[model samples]
Target: MSTVVETILSNHPQAKRDSLIPILQEVQEMEGFISREAIASIGKHLNLPTSKIYGVATFYNQFRFQNVGKYHVMVCRGTACHVKGSAKVLEAVKRELKIEPGTTSRDGLFSLEIVACMGACGLAPVISINGEFHAGVEPDKIKGILNAYRRKESENVK
Candidate 1:
């Protein structure tokens, strides 16, 4: 993990203020989430306080402080999606996974995120599991969708 962070910092020798977001994005991509160690290393590289780094990162919705679940579920709540009963769909997901938005399930199988838009309004009421779109989704369909993923993971475990 330190080596990965070191390599990322090395890429930005200057470590300008503007580089903070990019650095966080890259580190998150590599390590799944922002670690305290990464923040300290970034702070040292940028000559900024760790508080400042945390402040900046917390301001953005894109940065995640915790590791995501294996099945990262993003549910769209755009106008079209909402009009198509996405609220019900979202509720179904929460009920099925037993976790709210921005949180991973206790079993580490699912994480839920509410997005403003996914640009697939034509397929309103959409949810994506690890970027595999399940469009025109209804409340009843959520269980099957989740069960399919759970079954697939269980199969892999064996």
Candidate 2:
């Protein structure tokens, strides 16, 4: 078992069925997502079926099945933002990153998520990268934003 999987599983005993959600949350916190190996390990540890674990995890929107990339992008598609052309902005991001929502870019530098609302109605079209919000986003501005992140990544390696 992976260290994270083993470590978390160690904390929750087999008899504590109510601890499943907490265990899953901790695994996701440490590993970035709930991996398949983690599901299997958790199942074996809890004496529960893997399908049951998956069912519980799937019932909640908080669990992520795939690992998030270094820069997680969340695009607001709420009613207000949608009216202000967030769709175009979303398309722009998809083009710039060459990735769909709920997916990571090929190089693992970026991941995309579409959120229903950010409560930033004033900023009709907004995109957030790693919690940094970019307000009043326009399709034309997407390339520059992505390039800036790419530049930052390259600089980090240097």
Candidate 3:
């Protein structure tokens, strides 16, 4: 009965009621993560089963069940990046964030993920933060980049 659920259902009333995945994706993109209540509400709105909605959500890697951080970091693990020391870059990020891949920091300021490729092989060893790509990164620069994001976040909080 939330406004978000009503709005989404209104927009796609004629859509296949079972196609809740795309609706959930849009909700998550806007809200940063999907809550269980939202999922259930969506199911009710579509007149579909909650179990079916959950099944679709768990089936996709793109869907996140938990809240994500203010910043999401993706390190490319493609062949080109791997050859150019991507593993070291990933390790440095892990140390800086103190969280493994697919997890957000305790403060919800960062989430780290290992991606297959960012399609920037020409700029191997790339990392993306909130969709902003940084190319030709070295281990030494990793800390600085993370620090910069943290600084930006601090500024925003002020």
Candidate closest to the true structure, highest lDDT: 1
Model 2 Cα lDDT, one tens digit per residue, 37-145: 9999988888889999999998886787878889999999999999999999999999888987777887889999889999999988999999999999999999999
- Alpha carbon lDDT at 40, candidate 1: 96
Candidate with more favorable, higher TM-score: 1 or 3: 1
- By TM-score, the best candidate is 1
Position 148, candidate 2: lDDT? 96
Better of 2 and 3 by TM-score: 2
Which stretches in model 1 have alpha-carbon errors above 4 Å? none
Error of 2 at 131 (Å): 2.0
The TM-score values for the models, in the order shown, are 0.83, 0.80, 0.72
Residue-by-residue lDDT tens digits, candidate 3, 24-133? 97788776677788888888778888888878887876777667788999999999999999999999999989998867899989998889988999999999999999
- Cα lDDT over the full model 2: 0.90
Off by over 4 Å in 3: 14-17, 46-52, 100-102, 139-141, 152-158
Alpha-carbon deviation at 139 in model 2, angstroms = 2.5
lDDT of 1 at 54: 95
